[model samples]
Target: MSIRPIEPDDHAALLALWRRTPGLRLRPEDEFVPFCAYLQRTPGLSLLCERQGRLLGCVLVGHDGRRGYLQHLVVDQPYRAQGVARALLRRALEQLAGLGVQKSHVFVLRDTPESLAFWSAQAAWEARGDIQVYSHSEESP
Candidate 1:
C-alpha cells in the first residue's frame, strides 16, 4: 500500500469507509468537506494509505508547536493486521520529531479491546497504567 496525503477528492471514499463500520458516528458527507479543506491548508501531515487507486486506510496527525496529537487512525477492516496503521503511525512520529515535538498523546477508548491491544503492544510507547480519563456532562437544571 502507498501512503500519501489526503486529497479533497478522497472525501467520498473516506466517508464510505466509515459508513461500512457499525456503530460509528454518522456525519453528513458535507460535514467532512471542510475538514479536508482545513487539513490541506494546515500542512501536509495527514496520510492516506491507498492500493490500486483505492483508499485502504488513513491517519491524521495534528500538532501545536510543542506537542502532537495522534488525532485519528483508522484502517479498513481488510487492511488491518497488515501493518498499515503501524506504518502510518511511524510516519507521523517521524514528522512530529522533525517539528521538535517532544511529547505525543493518543487516547484509546476504554471499551475497545482492539485499541487496548494495539497500544499495549507498542514497545516504545509507555503505558500509563494509572492514568484515568474523565469527562463531565451537564444536564438541564
Candidate 2:
C-alpha cells in the first residue's frame, strides 16, 4: 500500500471507511470538521494508506511538544492482515520522533478487543497494565 499524507478532500472517504470498519465509534461527519483542519495545521502527522486508489488504512498523530498522541487508526477489513496499520504507525512514530516527542501514546477503546490486542502486541513501553482512562465530553454535565 502507498502511504501518503491525508488531504482535506479525503474526509468523505474516511467517513465512509469508518462507517464500514468495526471497533470504531466515530463522531458524526458534520461534527468532525477539525480533522482536516488539524491535519493541515500539523502537516505530515496524519496519514492514509491506499492502493490503486482504494483506501486501505489511516492514522492521526499529534503532540503537545512534550509527547505525542495517536488516534483514529483504522484499517480496511480486507487489508487488516497486510500490515497497513503497522506501516501507518511506523511512519507516524518516525514523524513524531522528528518533532522531538520522546514519548508517544495511543488511546484504544477497551471495547475493541482486536484493537487492544493489536496495540498490546507491539510491546508498548511499560504496557500500563493497571491504568484507567477518564474523560468528560464537552456536552457532559
Candidate 3:
C-alpha cells in the first residue's frame, strides 16, 4: 500500500467511502467546494492510503497556526485492523510536527463504539476529561 497526500480529485471517492463506513458522519464542509477550499487552505496535510489504484482509507488534517485538528479518519471495512488508521495518523502527526504544530486533537463522537475503541487503544493519545467543548454556529439558534 502507498500513502499519499490527498488531492482535489479524491473528493467523490472519499465521500463514497465515508458514506459506506458505518460510524463516520458527513457534514456540509464535506461537500466539494468546501472540501477543495480546505485542501487549498491546509495544503498537503490531509492524506489517503491506496493500493493498486484503490483508496483504502483517508484522514483530513488541518491546523490553526498552533494546534492541529484531525477529521474523517476512516478505513474500508475490509481493511480494518490492519494498521491503515494508525499509519494515516502517524503520517498526519509527522506532517504537523514539520509545520511546528506540537499539539493535535480529534473529536470522536460518544455514540461511535468502534471509533471509541480504536482511539482508546492508541498508546500515544489521551482521552481528555478535563475540558468541555462548546460551539456556536450562526446557522443554529
User: Which candidate has the top score in TM-score?
Assistant: 3
lDDT per residue as tens, model 2, 47-104? 9999999999998778889888888899988889788888998899999899888798
- lDDT per residue (tens digit) for residues 57-114 in model 1: 8876777788787744778888899999899999888888888986888877667677
In candidate 1, how many clashes are counted?
0
Q: Give me the overall lDDT of model 3.
A: 0.95
- Candidate achieving the largest lDDT: 3
- Tell me the TM-score of each prediction against the true structure: 0.80, 0.89, 0.96
What would the per-residue lDDT of candidate 3 be over residues 1-141, giving only the tens digit for each residue?
999999999999999999999878888889999999999999999999999999999999999999999999999999999999999999999999999999999999999999999999999899999999997656835
Error of 1 at 109 (Å): 0.9
- Residue 72 C-alpha lDDT in model 2: 87
Pairs of colliding residues, candidate 2: none
User: Which scores higher on TM-score, 2 or 3?
Assistant: 3
TM-score, predicted candidate 3 vs. hidden true structure: 0.96
Model 2 vs. true fold: TM:
0.89
- lDDT, each prediction: 0.76, 0.83, 0.95
